[model samples]
Target: METPSTSTSSYQRDDGPVRATLVGIGLTVFGLLMANVLTTPAFLFDPALLEGLGNGSIAGRTLALILNFVGMFLAGLLYLLATGRGLAWIDLRIPSRRDWKYIVAGGVGSLVFLFAFNIVTTLLEVSAAESQIMEIIGGDQTMILIMIVVVFLFNAPAEEFLFRNVIQKRLYAAFTRMQAVVVASVIFALVHFPMYVAFADSLLSTLASLTVMFGGALIFGYVYAKTDNLLVPTAAHAVLNAFQFTVLYLAIEYGIEEVQAEPATLAEVADAVWTVAVALA
Candidate 1:
């Protein structure tokens, strides 16, 4: 398929595959460090700052999320400045009704991909890694509700802007749309390696998480490549995350057990089905 937007700069047009891949990896690594690594300093800077901000505390989660948001954009800004690029490179725009079609497709596709991947890992005797968000919010209904907006307003936008808009787009200089998307997706997934290491119980579980994240990243990259609209992937990402949190919130409200990212999850599968049905309608 022809990509709607092509890299137009002389540098973009002239870069070779090896250079593009290396630079893409570098940018992704830098972005990850900014968002994830910088998070540790909160405790080091002042232990008092962490008084009410740990794990299940709303204050802690919110602060971490806010810092994450700032970190992503901070790295992106520096990258743009150092590379002589502009904000236009990471095109952020309001979606039209037409764009919404791609957004919904991307969102539904991501959910379905995640469910299927988890199921496959289970069959292979490896459980998928649960999202850290589940650990953060726990049974706090207020935090669950807060996450719905945070993922959309802060997390999704920051991540999509750095990963999809910048990192994935950078690969366009040397790769086809599909190839670029795949490569970028891998990088995006690996960026979460540390989280998996911290949260996953075994190597297989960590791999499963990386695999599932890579698949979801593929959807994010493809929709952005197709529409050349950053918002498509951003909204899709927000939908994917918010969907999980919403499910947990509802489960808690109904006094159900804590949800985990496991195979054959009836709630997720059912909700995804409903999403597809509505999308198709």
Candidate 2:
């Protein structure tokens, strides 16, 4: 009888409990909560935390940017420590040349799908998802820029490594592809609960985010299954995030401010409904 080749098998057969990754995610969440807590004003009489601190000067914006970097770095570190993996994973140096090609293609394709889906859903109106998204994001271009940078460059990489490459990969070793996607997607969505609560009033935006995020998880998981490599999904995630951020910047740059109409178009309403139907299906 021929022995099973270890090389053809998944790495890390021990497949330890995703404790480390979960810990890392937890610590990062805690750090964010702390950041928000510390920044809050001491009293009602005082102005809001981090409000107008830089006087709209370059120094102020630069300081804000620096702080954001610090936050991301700390959160990433905590996540790594909890997961028992060194920071090397975030560099994502394992993917092969073929992996890169697939990642790029998959990422771009997913972005296109998301963008088109949003446009259609917004037109259909079954969900008020788009406006809610804008509200949670807040109307601060500087802050939004900082967020985009952190998410794409720092948070996204670390998260993909932990969630997809590390945790999901291990899980898939014991489950089917669909099961892996479902588990990974649930975890991914849970991580964003804070953001959802922070923008509770934006029902449409919240729904939109839920759909986008879960859909992203499913796509990334599928990529991993196809390639058996973390690099593909990580790169794909980064591309999608960067693309979305770019679109947002373009909209803002073009002076597309808040929504003008009280009730969205019937088309948008219908799209929202269909998006939900598709997601549910």
Candidate 3:
């Protein structure tokens, strides 16, 4: 119901957006680098010791997911320490009833945005990066289950802690709430672009994927701002991601492939643009 205590005796009010931006950007870059190194198939497994752990294998995916989770958490913790803040600043407590409302709103908002984005992209003949991600999910039911758990428990919290709690909160000291929200959301969306680029066959598809991400990040930022609870946004994020993976799992199980979009007529493209504008409004 109330905002968490962000106060600290060691916290410096003068350390504003400049410090926040540097620390946020630095930790993100560092975390990605560490994740890549830690998840490298050659580094994690010896060819002779683990001949079956190829880059595309379930073992590799699991390892990479786990390592990436660890790397992000470590990076966040380090950022907190470096900034003279503590875990208390992150507001990782149980959500209050009001917080739950915000969480549900955030989750539903995300789903709505997702459906709208999907419709627009489908009309525009944009292929989804999710197809490639689903391929990585593969047909292994057990691995898929494990992935859902990891994403819900680890990835969601870790990302929310870093972006919303640390980065956005710090940015608040230097900018208006809306400005902080936009900047933080932009960073959040931009960081995910590499994955889309890796999977998308064309730049247009990658941009479309990033557009959806940006919209989702905007909603997440808005929720955190409104509720002032990290757990709310984190829970919402977890729910959204888990639901997505769940749908993917069911699709894979039932052999329902992603729908390929037909080439858009000029009118369809204009209509799709109008729809997006209306949705944004």
Candidate with top TM-score is 1
The superposed Cα distance between candidate 3 and the true structure at residue 18, in angstroms, equals 5.5
C-alpha displacement of 246 in model 1, angstroms? 0.3
Candidate 3 C-alpha lDDT tens digits along 65-97:
777777777777777787677665665667888
The C-alpha lDDT values of all candidates are: 0.72, 0.54, 0.67
Listed in order, each prediction's TM-score against the native is 0.82, 0.61, 0.80
What is the lDDT, from 0 to 100, of the residue 2 in candidate 3?
30
**Which residue ranges in model 2 land beyond 4 Å of their true spot?**
1-8, 11-91, 128-148, 197-205, 228-230, 258-281
lDDT of 1 by residue, 183-220 (tens): 99988888878877877788887887787778888888
**Cα shift from native, residue 173, model 3 (Å):** 1.6
* Model 2: how far residue 194 lies from native, Å: 4.5
Q: Point out the higher-scoring one by lDDT: 2 or 3.
A: 3
- Model 3 TM-score (2 dp): 0.80
Q: Model 2, range 218-267, lDDT digits (tens) per residue?
A: 88877776666656776787766555454455445555433222112111
Using TM-score, rank the candidates from best to worst. 1, 3, 2
Tell me how candidate 2 scores on lDDT: 0.54
